[model samples]
Target: MNTKAEQTKGASAGDIGKLTLAAVILVAVIVAYTWLGNGNVPQPVRLIGLLVGLVVALAIGAFTGPGRRVRNYIAESQFEMRKVVWPTREETIKTTAIIIAVTIVLSLLLGLIDLILKSVILDWLLKLG
Candidate 1:
């Protein structure tokens, strides 16, 4: 029995050509968008062309092995996301409030320490000079 890795072949020249074609199409889309000036083509028309070109290029790319892997990864991520037990709005708010309160208290403590250091260094040490 062939393992999943063994079942898959290395990228052939055809795959490279298809990926290159997709890249060329993407570049063409950018060129076409800019080449058609706003004075010649309406902004909406250019935008529509861009969207269509992007979709076509992406569609071509999605058939490739890497693209299929990306799709699988995204699907897995979405599936895993469904299993997450997200905190409620009340819990989030309370957590945020506690964090803010702690941060403020920490800041006050640090500021007091800094003030004491400055007083000791500048007031005491500098006066001796």
Candidate 2:
């Protein structure tokens, strides 16, 4: 229930301790995964360990101030998305076709200009030299 001003302020000792513990767990998990590759552990189990570690770290961090802001931002983004007017399939296809046509035409125009400049340089400038 903290305001933006309070959240933006420096983290308290408890938050820092929680964040550090989360980081340590993350590093331990990664090291364990790497070590497991050299032992008899299966790849799937190692991957699961990594995933579980990530989730645990994330959960721990979610109690901090920044995590609440991120959650709020995501919720607001989802709400705003509902108000967006997305293009229909036919509109998208037509827009895509127009873009492709414009690109092709511009490329051909550029190629023609390049060829003309090359011809002028080789035939006229070289003969003068």
Candidate 3:
């Protein structure tokens, strides 16, 4: 018996159709938002429409046969993401500080070289004058 985990494949055409339907609904919402002329449509209603549409699409995906597997796969992926080990605050700060220190040092070195070249050029120009 194989000890490795079995890999789940992507959705079939019918499942893709369900996903496409959901995307079309999202695009329609965007089109509606833009069509409101002056962006003054009540914000709450717009938000509600988006939420409702998403819920309905998810419901359809869950209930439909092909969509069910696709939706389940997505849910499983999200669950897996929750198990990730994120960097600690101290580690993040240390990395950021190192980056900043390197950038400052490089900038200063470049500026000193630029000043030296400019001084040499100005002296050569004065001699020619």
Which prediction has more favorable lDDT, 1 or 3?
1
Residue 129 error, candidate 2, Å: 1.8
* Model 2: number of backbone collisions: 0
- Give the poorly placed runs of model 3, Cα more than 4 Å off: 1-11, 36-41, 58-95, 125-129
Q: List model 3 lDDT by residue over 5-90, tens digit each.
A: 86567677777787778778877777776666367788778777777877776775666566665676787888888988999999
Question: Tens digit of lDDT per residue, candidate 2, span 74-111?
Answer: 88788888989999999999999999999999999999
> Can you list the residue pairs that collide in candidate 1?
none
The local distance difference test score of each candidate is 0.88, 0.90, 0.77
Ranking by lDDT: 2, 1, 3
Per-model TM-score, in order, reads: 0.84, 0.89, 0.54
Best first by TM-score, ranked: 2, 1, 3
Worst 10 residues of 2 by lDDT: 1-10
RMSD of 3: 5.2
Model 3: ten consecutive residues of lowest lDDT: 1-10
Model 1, 1-129: lDDT tens per residue? 222553367766776777889999999999999999646799999999999999999988888877787787788788888989999999999999999999999999999999999999999999999
